[model samples]
Target: MAIVTPLKTAAEQTLVQQFAEAKGELPGGPAVRKLREDAFAGFEAKGLPHRRLESWRYTDLRSLLREARPLADGAKETEAVTARLASLSLTGLRLVLIDGVFAPELSALDAIPEGVTVHSLADALVQPRDDLGRILSGPSVGADDAGLALNTALMRDGVFVEIAEGTELSQPIVIIALASAESERAVFSRSVVLAGKGAKGTVVEVSEAAGSAAQQVNGAIVFETGDESEIQHVRLLTRQQAASVEVQSLLVTVGASAKFDSFALVCNAGTVRQQHFVRFAGEHSEIGLRGVNLINKAQHSDVTLIVDHAVPHGTSRELYKTIAGGEATGVFQGKVVVRPHAQKTDGGMKSNALLLNEGATMFNKPELEIFADDVVCGHGATVAQIDGDQLFYLMARGLPRVQAEALVLQAFAGEAAEFIADEAVRELVMGEVEGWLHAREAAAEVSTV
Candidate 1:
């Protein structure tokens, strides 16, 4: 019998050539370069994640990504880009990245918040700290993932933040990763956050587009929480171009007696995947993960996560809400793992989706892998259309059909958004939801007209 090798996809071939050409120019010392080489080797072996892989069955990158765009160059903060960045500003310590390159002029680095230290990843890599490799390597949960491997191999620049022990930040830290429509290219960035023991703070990451050009952004953020610390993270993925592709991952390791809470809002994205890989590294920790996905008009959105209970007395709660209208598609894949010695673990997960029309689609896959008998774990999922009774009740009360539907959808998605610990952040998320609903209503009116 003769053995034959599979043909490489165009994207894979382009990525290989890019790596070989840019290997020497990428930041980092020998150790970091070796790490990148190893990561690219892994990707070269696996190729792009396809439907054959159980984890990537729903959103197949191999099929979706026809060809690879050239690597993003150093983008100039043009007048238009500056105006766009200004509009997305929030009241906090803001760090901005344009085309995956750190923009110091736009970032609020001159203030130097009291107990917090920030550095550009590119600078850190060139200097090469001992722990930098470990941080960039990421946790075991997603270390072997193909997308993550590619990110590690090509990651150019991102923000690195450290909070001093026992320090409480006065305001949230906002990091914005914005794409430049002037360049049709790919951007890969990796960011890290280290919360010292007993410290408390909130971090918000906003991934938005500068204009209506198609681009690719593959980014990852790693978070490590110390014992007795509390950290709140909010990720808002919005206003993506219709033909753009975005893959973002959150990798976290929670410490003993610490509290970690995260929320993600996905709206108006083209092809997007928001994944989370979390591990309870210490005992007696608690985590809450929640998200809402609003997609319509041929958009594709996916939220996949894995929560690992590697220690005893860990607790996790997850809930996700999705609204798919027009010809959009939404997917939620969640799994919770309880190690054999992870006794006294408590976990609960639920996914609820509302389809606004016959053309919309939703996929929910919830699973649990428990090796411990002394644990409490359960999962549930529900998918349905708007409740006719509720809609009728609103309409009979003098509200128009569009307004009634919007109200109903708002209430349905509010349960997940209300979990944000910060009042202002929660409201900001709701505002995005309202904006999406308004757009939906306008589109409906146009269709009827």
Candidate 2:
């Protein structure tokens, strides 16, 4: 007798079918094509991770994605997208991707900066350089996740950037991905950045889903810092609540004596999940990971970070803060692992959240796994609301209840934002924080009225 297994969910079935049919027309050579097959198989077997999985207990993917949206058309652009580009303050090279497609018309790179090389992912795939062929064809760029796999299978056009050895960029490089005027469409985008040995630079990724129809966007970033180099990365999410779902991921490898600082701010999107994977590949590497989540409404936001210490004499620091209002839900899960041979490792992780209403929910989980005898690793999490005494003090000083609460919120969130070394970036984040606070206050007034 032959038995048949039940079919996967509609969304899962659609992803598999789309990849199978569009595999050839996607990109890359045989190696990448095969990798796509393996990735699809892995996702097929697992379907979508749910509460059953330890890694995804708080946020369930299978239930959130009921049906798969069609792939986004990368070749088109809308006037709204062009209009929105005028608001960004550009002090560096700008690369804009409209609706998952690279838009050179909107980008500002009049002259190629010295000591830097740039190529679109599509261009690199067509005529792979002897040095970049193997990397471009590598399987999934070592990011292990279903969303990343989906991005790998559908990654056709993105930016591939490299900084020459010992070159310090005069200005930061900004890559903006805008999903403008797209509804029920799936956006797949990926990028790779290489900071050459002893190089110094800043790379900022801004994801904009604002002022557009509801869309599904999945993005992945792979960054490598060479020995004795320094790299700064900032991920700012400014999507609107209309977006059905979003998955943003970061994969970083720090080399010996290199320094890496990564900061993220999440203040938008209805359902957004952030996954960050950091690996210390050599000794004497230093890293700092920090983020803040400002969420409201009935939306959901999740931030999961993993930092692995695989070598001796490495150090990592992580701090995350979340503020939830209305009936929104926020989640923070962070893990640090020190291998057996990774002695002299120093790692610390801390996450704190604040709930503004009774219906608001915040899930916090911090874990430390250590196999080395000579290591200092610890993790802690705290979830709380506004301190009554603090509120009373502000209220006694003639501040309204709303203003007092907002002040307390700013103090709580500013702790994480202060970790950003760049003054400009810090100010930018603070501005966004104020904007969100005002929006929350306005919403509260409307509800009461």
Candidate 3:
């Protein structure tokens, strides 16, 4: 008999080496170390996710990531961060994380209003907390995924927000995550947002590259809502590094009679995979998930989501829009699952993509798994180019071809953008959309010239 050992990729080997070297320095207690070891073992067994996995059919990390960069060290107040801070439009309460580490100097920690508590994960890990383990181990959805397992293993520092019961916030809590280009590194950050019973508020997560240097960012956010709570979450990925590789995950558990809404905007990136795993843990809950993706050049962007209806009387709505140009590739994969005992589940999902050039490609996979006969679930997907008639109508009005195309694209993306719960947030997202369009227009002019 011949014995053969499977060879590991450079990235996988580098990850293993990093974990072995940094496990002691990571946060958490004895239990957390054990958790980290277990997670790393899982990742070692499976290696990087590839096209062989059903969930990662479109985005192959093994092939895309040939080598892993060094892990990010602690961040300091630098010129890049200062410039980013100067350019940002201040709104609401802001928390800053530079290179995956919480920055107190850059964050408005003192301005946090009453009834809201903020704790840095690095600081919190030094103390003992009962629910810390549960927060670290996300919900059942995608818990076993290799990428998420890696996140759990080498997770560094993030923000933990807790809303007091029955507290209603007047403004949204903003979490700004910046990747500085001082050096090429890989960053792993995990954050949690807990909404107590009857609490109401909004959270906005903004991710941006402070400079042009490409960085690898593996980030996750967990949202747990108590019964009858209302929480709105918006994730914005704007001005990302052109050669960056970003894998962002969202895990949510909605309680009984709770209202949860989440929206994402992906305007620019090199390679990004934004995935959501949402479970309705209690009955009579409702959720809305929406996103818009704008990609050009050779960039690749993927949005994958799974909504699990594990209880009765759960409602979910998901809509996503993608605009692909140049030779970019876009993917949207949304699945809604109605368990056997989850009767009275109402779920609807739609994915629409627009290709701007002949070489551009879009992949849409909308699915529904209905184990309960009494549930109402439906899904639809469409991939098409811009309508010639609409373009002609705009061109007939003396609009340039590029401008007419931009109008059509904006209107197509607006349908999904309107679902953002907050008006100010919606307008902010649309402004990013317009910025994307303007960049496209400039590129068009350059190409023509």
Pairs that collide, model 1 = none
Q: Where's the lowest-lDDT run of ten residues in candidate 1?
A: 73-82
Model 3 off-target regions past 4 Å?
Answer: 1-4
* Model 2, span 282-322: residue lDDT tens: 89999999988998878888988888888899999999999
Estimate, for each residue in 99-179, the C-alpha lDDT of model 1 and write its tens digit. 888898999898668999999888888874888787787668887789989999999999989999998987889998888
lDDT digits (tens) for residues 313-378 of candidate 3:
999999999999899999998989889999999999999999988999999888888999998888
| CA RMSD of all predictions | 1.1, 2.2, 1.3
List the candidates' TM-scores in order.
0.98, 0.94, 0.98
Off by over 4 Å in 1: 1-3
Worst 10 residues of 3 by lDDT: 121-130
Query: After TM-score superposition, what is the CA distance of residue 30 in candidate 3 from its true location, in Å?
Result: 1.2
Model-by-model lDDT, in order? 0.91, 0.81, 0.90
Candidate 2 deviant stretches above 4 angstroms: 1-6, 127-144, 446-449
Let me know the TM-score candidate 3 reaches against the reference structure.
0.98
Compute the lDDT of residue 222 as modeled in candidate 2: 78
> Against the correct fold, how does model 2 do in TM-score?
0.94
